[model samples]
Target: MIFFLIFCVTSGFSTLLNQDTLDVIYRYVQKTPFKKIFERSGSEASFINEAIPTAYDSRAVYPNCKSLTSVLDQKKCGSCWAFATTGSAADALCINGIANVIPSPQRQICCDNKCLEIPLKQCDYGCNGGVLTAASLYIENNGIVSDECIPYEENSSKPCFTSCSKEGVKMEVYKGLYAKIPSIMKVSENEMKKGIMIGGSIAVAMNVFQSFTLYKGGVYNRTDGDFLGNHAVRLVGWNDTAEVPYWIMINSWGTEWGMNGTCYYLKGKNLGNIESQTVYFSTTPPTYHGRQVSVSFSLIFIFLLVSFTAVLYLLSYVCGRINEGEKKRDLQEKEARTQMLREIGERRYKRGLKNRSSSSVRRRRLSSSENEDEKDTSTRMIDDSEEEEESEKDIEKVGLLS
Candidate 1:
């Protein structure tokens, strides 16, 4: 069964399963104006001008940002905007050496109503899909807590709790600063590379099609598929030398789907308008609200080293004790076998002696009986002869006795 499943995946027959997931994705990504009115803001210009490179990867540059590198699933909600915004914010924080905090997409998606309270008419569309740039704006003003704060609920209808973003129990506050950039201007190979080189993930949206859902590996180029809907994703890096030269994107469909929850889109092609619309975020320094212990990477490394040494020592001790027990058991078995053999030999010797003694006793009894019989016969004969001689004087009595 597993082999059949693997074969189906390899042969692209798993599109049936992927179609269902894509349907869910399409249904939730409700239409929004971000794509219509997206424009590069003043805040993003400085970051873009800061760095320029040919090729770059966030994982290579910032190893501490596991929250940035790891794949996340938006599930059956239209919260890709929140996920992308929060994800980029987290990476920016790590790159800037602020905090390795995975900000709550749930908070941004469900609890971020600060925009609603604003009179500027800037507000999130909620689960019906919102603009990453707009959401980043709200998050910047009112900092978001960690993912553990609220925890993303797949059901969008779930009420946003006020007590969700708690300190110590959940996470510390991670502030955000929004920067919107026109993805079209950076569609050029060098332009995108320069944008990515600055630091942090790039929040971008693309027209997700049927073929995209079934992407297993290799640089994906549009071959055949109808436009489904606009879906948000985080651009981490890109490969320029592939058969199709693709941008390595972190998808939100869980790690099990789409190249282990990541996909490669054709770079420079801008298929699905991916290169035309992208957003990036900058993070302000973190502010702790309550008592919390933020362990440094050095401390974590030391702890791991100590744990590994202790485990190695324990294993060595256990193995040594096992070897000793095996040796002792082998010796006991050898002694038991020797004792059994000795007992068998002694029993055989005693039986032989008993049999020999019984035979000797029988022989002696037979010999004595034979001698007695012969003596009796001789005495009878002599008595007969004496009786015969006496019979001459009193033969009648002797003859009568014979």
Candidate 2:
């Protein structure tokens, strides 16, 4: 399955599909209409005078600038202009050492819609398609809040509230951090690199094709493909040492769609007119008013939780000790009662033995006295019988003499 998907993406299977299907697949990129292209034109000096450097690369000098890069997902909305604008601004802030504050793209786009009196549509209305130059102008006039203040939801019908800066709800928004594009110039390959070196990332538009959506890696140049539309992106850095010289462009589709949410376009080829629509901007230092309070609240919550758990543990330990003492007392009481009962039983047994010995001696003395009385009575009876026999013999002799 993985191989099949790879084959499908790498083999330009999307090019075989109908235009409508291709539109559905590649609708995330919304470029300005061709009629509006003339709205932003640069002097010939910016393009013709700059020589395309043969072996120069900005990434080598500014290796940490990639950390300033922000990748976004337009999702179902066509907010590429907003993403490109805010993403470049964010990189500028990071490059300037204000890494904590990331400007909100939704706020930039939504506010631009409000300014243009454009009703937002899910597909291609306000956020669906917009010009990055217009968005930059809006940001410059009415600065936007941080992403934390107004997060991107990818919803167009949702109401755009006046930011805290405008509404004065709270002093959580800083207006000094908005970026401005004072000039937009048609730049050559070297001019684009110089713009990146001067200003972190610059927003550029390119012609997108169906095969472009399936771009995996390496230098990309559409030699043959179906043209869909012009899409906006932020060109951060480039590498000439690669297999093919490529311009590192960050897309708004997602990280999963490209090489870490970045695409490598073939450098110096003017493929998709990537170098033609490049523009540079100057940024103000970012301010993060809400981030401080959020960090404080988080610390307080963690402290309270730890304190509560410690109190609970202390109570458990005290209760367990009390129970142990009670159990020990109960065992001691039981042992004392058993010992008392054993001593009482021993005393009763000794008394019973003593009484049995005294009763036996008394019975023996009474039996000896009764035996002596019986013997005397027997002797008295024998003498009385002998006397009666002698009287009877004397009376018989006197009768014979008469």
Candidate 3:
């Protein structure tokens, strides 16, 4: 993968055939030191939210679009259609007053398996891939599944029976809202707050270019891959700030893939920002505003990371000292043991009158014991020096305030 990624960087395309966008993703992934950086990448929240932090991935709902609140698949198989269909069904159900619940992809693959014209291949539905629209259309025609009757039988080798179809159910489709604006920053917070709780999906339009791959990190003016994803998303709402009006959009990728699992369209560049990875996502408006209650929660996350790091350093310090102390005690014990052994050897030598030439091994062991004490002292000095340096970092450098 590393060789292929570098090759894509040099060639301005990926070897994944048509998956050139993946090359851009590779560039960013290679450079990313932290996998979870995007979670904290959004602009600082307003004073209210700044006091608290929000943990919701921000994309998990819709803006007055009737959130389906259904289960989402993370591409366990190339069966994107199942996720999309199940997702759209959740939206449709909420519109029809159905409660939020987990949907089964197994029913579609098991009962219908769509046409099943060709014999099953070894890799079928086993993360190789499948059509998402087919899954949605199949669900629409065959109706949804029951977990007890047809739970998720993902990546199944056996194809489903043809007669195991559910009766197709009718659904209502609600068109998502869209508006052209000079800037997204112009959207007011009051206007944006309610969109989150309403629950819906959104689609964004952009000029997608090849450089969109570089959207992974740092900054980019252009990408080096083909546009391969959607730009539409749910409009949860807006930040009211006149300085930086931004609409938060969620994408169907993981948190490591983009914008801490969400995207913020910069005020001027939200449009035609293919190189910027402007993509679509969903969320609810009221829930969006309500998130402000814990806006300052980001600080807590930062505090936890710092605290954990400090504790690790503290443990190393304490452990090092304890280890050194133990080594010192062990060295003392060893010297005592060697001295007792030497005394016994001397007494025996005296009683038997053994010649020096025969007792050479004992003599060398005694000499080694003497050198070990010297090495121990040297190690002790080095450790004491390290302790002094660490103590210095803990002290604040004071300046004379005149």
Best TM-score goes to which candidate? 1
* Higher-scoring candidate on TM-score, 1 or 3: 1
How close is every model to the real structure, measured as TM-score?
0.54, 0.49, 0.31
Where does candidate 1 stray beyond 4 Å? 1-51, 113-123, 159-161, 165-171, 183-191, 283-402
**Per-residue C-alpha lDDT of model 2 across residues 120-165, encoded as one tens digit per residue:** 1212245568765556545544555677677778866665656543
Cα shift from native, residue 103, model 1 (Å): 2.4
Candidate 2: where is the Cα deviation over 4 Å?
1-67, 114-125, 164-185, 283-402
Cα lDDT of model 3 by residue, 1-402, tens digit: 644543344344212212212212222222244324322222222322532222122234332332332223344444444444444444444433453444455654554454321111211242344433233324433455443334454554656634333345333222221111112223333223322322232223344455542356422334346755433233333443535545554434445644554455443443454223211212211121212312222333345555776798799999999999999999999999999999999998886765565578788888899899889999999888888777665453332322
lDDT of each: 0.64, 0.60, 0.41
lDDT of 1 by residue, 117-191 (tens): 211233566688876546655555566677777777765565665665455584467664534343323355554
Count clashes in each candidate, considering only residues at least 3 apart in sequence or on different chains: 1, 0, 57
In candidate 3, stretches whose alpha carbon ends up further than 4 angstroms from where it belongs are 1-73, 109-133, 146-157, 161-199, 202-260, 264-402
- Using TM-score as the yardstick, the better of models 1 and 2 is 1
Best-performing candidate as measured by lDDT: 1
Arrange candidates by lDDT, descending.
Answer: 1, 2, 3
Q: Compared to the true structure, candidate 1 yields what TM-score?
A: 0.54
**Best to worst by TM-score, what's the order?**
1, 2, 3
